[model samples]
Target: MRAADWSTPRLGLSELPVIEVPNHALAFGWSSKSGPIRRRVDDCPVASRDGPVRRQRARWAEDRRSDDAIATLIVPIEVGIGLRRRPIDDVNAWLDTDVATHLEG
Candidate 1:
């Protein structure tokens, strides 16, 4: 199997940090002021790079299946070891319908 490219706008979350089983995916639970949510991704999408440490902004948008609209957006303003939380300002900043899409499949 091959890893998915991460250098494109289609990429959302950061590189996952854990052991992965081939052909399987994982989802992590996150909390916010509204309630709790989950972020799911296939593990075969992270790319490897070298050199000095670099930082990348990781943002998440949740689109409700009912109304086909985004209900929550989370952006972590601060990060720590195994813990991350987004401030209200950051959430508001990145929350928008910039990527809304409709597909006929």
Candidate 2:
């Protein structure tokens, strides 16, 4: 199947992170090709002053059906790269100094 078919709305990436999937989930150990593959994307939550509403008020019925159909059944694999140090600290430090004069105001 084409990667586009598996594209998840919540996930911005163009391709599925299949590499992150665990081998144990596969019927066989690990093979370049083989075994069942599934993909899904959930609805984005609505954040408002009212405080974290679980349901979307607009097109509620239609959205529920679409959300349910999308979440039917699928195995997922999470893949991420670990950083030796947090990047945010360095970024904040840099921006806090002369580099980001706009924020000083």
Candidate 3:
């Protein structure tokens, strides 16, 4: 689906400030070795495997160039080994145990 092009968006008066229009956003927290990492393969072919030089970055900010109030939604989940539905408690425990051993599994 796409935005309807039937009418033009009017930037007129409003109670909410323009900068506060989009006062929300989401940010995904991936491992540093995954993303937000510099493409410095030249510096070290296996720079990613050379221990964590940079920690996992799950940060958010309002870019000085834009008025969008981006908000970060970071949630911690368990890292089980097997493919099985983990219990709600286990999922939020942040454990790295095998899912198969779980009672629910």
Query: Top TM-score: which candidate number?
Result: 1
Ranking under lDDT, best-scoring first? 2, 1, 3
Model 3 misplaced stretches (Cα beyond 4 Å): 1-55, 60-68, 81-105
- Pick by lDDT: which candidate is best? 2
Candidate RMSDs in Å, in order, are 16.1, 18.1, 20.1
Residues 13-91 of candidate 2: C-alpha lDDT, one tens digit per residue: 3543332334443233343222222122233221111111223322342454376532121112223532213333343
TM-score list, all predictions: 0.21, 0.19, 0.19
For 20-103, candidate 1 gives per-residue lDDT tens digits of 333422224322311211323221122222212223212323224224443333333222332122233342234333322221
Q: Please list the residue runs of candidate 2 whose C-alpha ends up more than 4 Å from where it truly belongs after superposition.
A: 1-79, 82-85
Clashes of each: 0, 0, 0
Better candidate by lDDT, 1 or 3: 1
Local accuracy of candidate 3 as per-residue lDDT tens digits, 1-104: 11111111221113211111222333363443432332322121110111222234233211311344222222333333321233323332322343223323
Error of 2 at 39 (Å): 31
State the weakest 10-residue window (summed lDDT) of model 2.
45-54
